[model samples]
Target: MGTKIVAVYENGVLRPKKKLNLPAGTEVELIIRPSLKGLIKLFEGVEVKKDAESALNETRERKLWE
Candidate 1:
């Protein structure tokens, strides 16, 4: 079974927001994914050359309907 938890990286360590129910010295794999809020903040105030509809139409014309 796999568990999903939110964690923060601090001082070269990953600190889990909540305590885990695992024994000491337990090994687990980590798959890191940024949160939605984090992604939004990452691209905040970024400029775009074209609107969404225009971009989609261009993509359809070049890729789908070509």
Candidate 2:
């Protein structure tokens, strides 16, 4: 895991931004930490319920295809 790969924490999982050449079920240690932007986003305050609800109700899916 020496190669640093950036991933986005979407929903409740880390989605890698690039293709990985690893096999399935590979047990690797993960150092879960927030990026600078993510740390700053924490102070963005509560999102509006209407906006949040609308976003959640959308039909579009989020996929990690890089």
Return the top candidate by lDDT.
Answer: 1
lDDT string for model 1 (7-66, tens) is 988999999999999999999999876676765775578665799788667646865323
Give each model's whole-structure lDDT: 0.78, 0.66
Return the lDDT, model 2, position 18.
Answer: 100
**Tens-digit lDDT string for candidate 2 (1-66):** 277789987799988999888899877777776676865575367454577566445413432111
Instruction: Assess candidate 2 and give its TM-score to the true structure.
Output: 0.52
Model 2 misplacement above 4 A: 44-66
| CA RMSD of all predictions | 7.5, 11.0
